[model samples]
Target: MLTTRIRNVDTDAQADAGMQSLNEPDFKALVDSHPKAIMLTAQDGSIAYVNDQFERVTGYRQEEIVGHNPSILSSGMHSREFYIDMWQSLERDKRWEGLIWNRRKNGETYPQWLNIYPVEHEGGAFYTGVFMDVGELTANDERLAALAYYDPLTELPNRTLFQEFLKARACQREPADRCFAVLFIDLDFFKSVNDLHGHDYGDRVLKQAAVCIQGVLRKGDLVARLSGDEFAAIVELQEPSEINAVCERMASAFRKPVSVDFREYFLSASVGAALYPRHAESASDLLLKADRAMYAAKTAGRACYRVYSAEESEQGQHQQMLSEALVASLKVAPEEFSVMYQPQYDLRSGAMVGMEALMRWRHPELGAVSPGEFVPLAEQRGLIHELTEQLVRCITRDLTRHDFGTHGNMRLAINISARQIADDRLEVLLEPFFTRLQLAGWCPELEITETHLMNLSPRCLDKLRDFGKRGVMVAIDDFGTGYSSLAYLHALPVHVLKIDRQFVQRLGPDSRDSRIVSAILGIADALELEVVAEGIETEAQKAKLQELNCHRGQGFLMARPTPLESLVRQATSG
Candidate 1:
């Protein structure tokens, strides 16, 4: 509403009187005293009168604006069709309410919620427009849209946005012109980064990785973070070679170091690609093929890319089914899973000093499934945390039920997943296990791979150090197979090293494995760490390991991985 002098006319009261009841003088006063921004435009769209509020909102004097067309305040933000539609609504309904961006006399553009209503007078017909500022509302709408479609950490388009983009592009073209590529990328060893450095550093690495990915793509291509550590891209393909070049550039971009917290961390990513028309017809299928190809790249030893193939797609589908089944099974019937203990013998004493608990799965319909098959799948699906918890609970219950720990004082060796160690609540989870073991007079050792140790973040290192202080023996399993620096190995809070089977399998006089074994034993001796030789299948291997003073050994020759009942009988009988 406007507030300005209107000669002797009561324009404010006249407007409230619907203009018909008021004389010209009363109409003038009525329009002048109104509080809203009210502008009266003649039938031809020329400005008839503007109230004080109109001049205040537009920063124009009434005399300067009154003689001009309402177009003088146009922000140039709307198209001709917009005005055509607005007039259509005004004519049909007598009033139209909408938002418009208009420029002020100071050249600043702002949004306003405007209403246009027809006004009839004895002389002629006119329209009165009432408007108020709504710039903040416009900004809030944009902010809500961004929060819905973007990843907060990376600020890249998220899965919901990516799907919308794919849908829009698919509908924008004919089938023949629908040629594009979808590349699914998974960061390698990213979990280790989270485990070692902390999630904040991991998030920084992901943000940098997103930027690197965007830098490599063509101008029209779309890159998005599908989820944590997984990114997807939509690329326009010209020649088939373009996909290869783009993938190479993507991998190269990720190969660089990401500096976080004053430390530089190197990372690698595996890419899987699916080409439109060639790989599949739909965006969902294309994404699926690309995901399968990505898993194939992981299977081929990582740091590479693979194009979709029928074989890889089949295998990927099977793996996905298994992953889903694992998630469902964990929720519905985890007790359907079981643990078996493999005896670990002391070569010098010829006695069972410990047993390593191994997970075994037997589905009601799928029959027996190897831990090798399902464990990694669970890790991929983020079910490993639950699986590990179930495993500890089962093993602890078995130990308590059989009284095996008291029977032979046999130590229980449990393999720990990186996810378990990274969990903030790991101390609480392990409290029961430690309490039960202490009551049984048996100490439990946690086995971790040498590779898992190599990437220990400072946080992971500190957590393991704390666990070690609590008297849980930390042993490195599959030692020789992983590349770990002596500096890192010496600094680790480890009490034992289990020589990998590949190294122990070749144990003989003057062999390379023998020399490596001797060196490992010497390092262990200097560090006051115990050494265990794994996969010793013969008396000859055992004798050779004993000659090198290896403290312990385990393999099929001692006993196969048996059920808890069998392990209990053996321990109690001994």
Candidate 2:
């Protein structure tokens, strides 16, 4: 009845008179003054009544719009299927709410947040639509999108957006016609810039570097900041030579000194290029090839570019094969992996004070795979966590079966990878072993590389400290090989420092390494921490370490890494 009355009052004068009659006067006033625009349509889909806000928002007077279909405001931006879905929802649920684009009387398109509800009356069913222009909200959404898809410091597309664009661009063309190159660019000696000048100056250099890189790329190309001191570009090319030309231009761009605070600093870039469809079929594979090529360039010495070559491709293929084989071995043949323990000795007393657990893999086809070779590979393939868990299980089982704690106050040290230390699951996995060792009066030690220790977050350091409180010792393995900062040496919750083999093997009278080792021992003594010299191969090296008061050492001279069963057998024989 209300719809019929409103529809009949089409003239402006009649509409004004009929508005109060169509509904309560207070209700009509409230609807008219409401902030949101409102429209009422008859069951036949013709506009019946519109509130004052609706006329102002749509730029159409009530009399002019009455009796017209709501489609008169359509922006034609939505497909037919979109409208079909909207109507289907309205019919099924009696209400619909969504964002829509509509045109005003002046032909200006604007986005609106709209809500529609069905009303039943004596005359027929009416539909009421309430909406508001959301142009400002849309602008805010765009700002949020930019934040998500860009690196704030350099204002370049981040890794997420770069990968998205790479995938999208690949999809837009046929596989055979996917002619492009991905260039992985790493700034050489950029860490020294941050180390020498602080992060503020480093940030300014990165921003300038971004501008310089973009200057070398074509208008249609995309360059993104992949991470700190690293950038990647998607380059369109007509031929393979064009990729080389682009890389040379990028290298040349960095030859110019970066200026900060009237000071000049020279920085060069190592660029690696891999072509699409030629190097790899997928974007991820292409990016990996580019990264590998970039590392090769860095190895060749900085400030140069290297195209992905057949040699690199062959190496990549070998790595791929190894990765696949490793995955299969992990899933189907975990028994191929076992734990070996090497005794750590007290050089002064000639007593075995500790044993370090080492991981050994014997593949059926590959024979003995060196931990040096496969361990880093496992880390890169994200299989390190799984491997570490398996090793933990094997070590715990061996310790329990052999009753290793019965061998006097022997401490057990397990090498923990950075990945494992950062993984929360690792704490859960090692908790039971910690409890067992605590009950047995044996101090269990976790050996983290000095490099990883320095890079660890405060949270990870806190975790190590918590372990210390629980009587678990934290030892820094391969000390002096990484940052070796005295700052962390004082700050980290460490119990022992294992001198790296590199420094230990060169120990001699008046040699630089011997002095370095002496300095390390002095620092450890001043800090009241224990020291273990690694890789002692000869009587002279062991004697030199003892002369330096290193006290504890582990090497082939004392004992090589052997399976727990073999070590137990040797003890039984003795």
| Winning candidate number (TM-score) | 1
Name every residue pair that clashes in candidate 2.
1-123
**Clash count list over all predictions:** 18, 1
Residue-level lDDT tens digits of model 1 in 182-201: 99999997887888789988
- CA-only RMSD, every prediction: 10.1, 12.9
Instruction: Look at candidate 1 and tell me the lDDT of residue 84.
Output: 72
Error of 2 at 413 (Å): 0.8
For every model shown, what is its TM-score relative to the native structure?
Answer: 0.68, 0.57
Candidates in order have lDDT scores of 0.78, 0.80
On lDDT, the leading prediction is 2
Tens-digit lDDT track of model 2 for 1-574: 0111223424555444433344667657877988789987765567877899898888999889987888889876555655666777877998887667788999987656678887654334567899876543322345535335567787777787677567545443443544889999999878768876899999999988998999999877888999999999999887767888898898888888987778888899989999887887577988888988886676566688888987965676666677788888888898998998999989999988888989988889988888987787787566887887778878878877885436765788988787566678889988888888767766799999988788877888889999999889889999898886677679999998899999999999889999999998989998999999999999999889989888789999989998888877877777
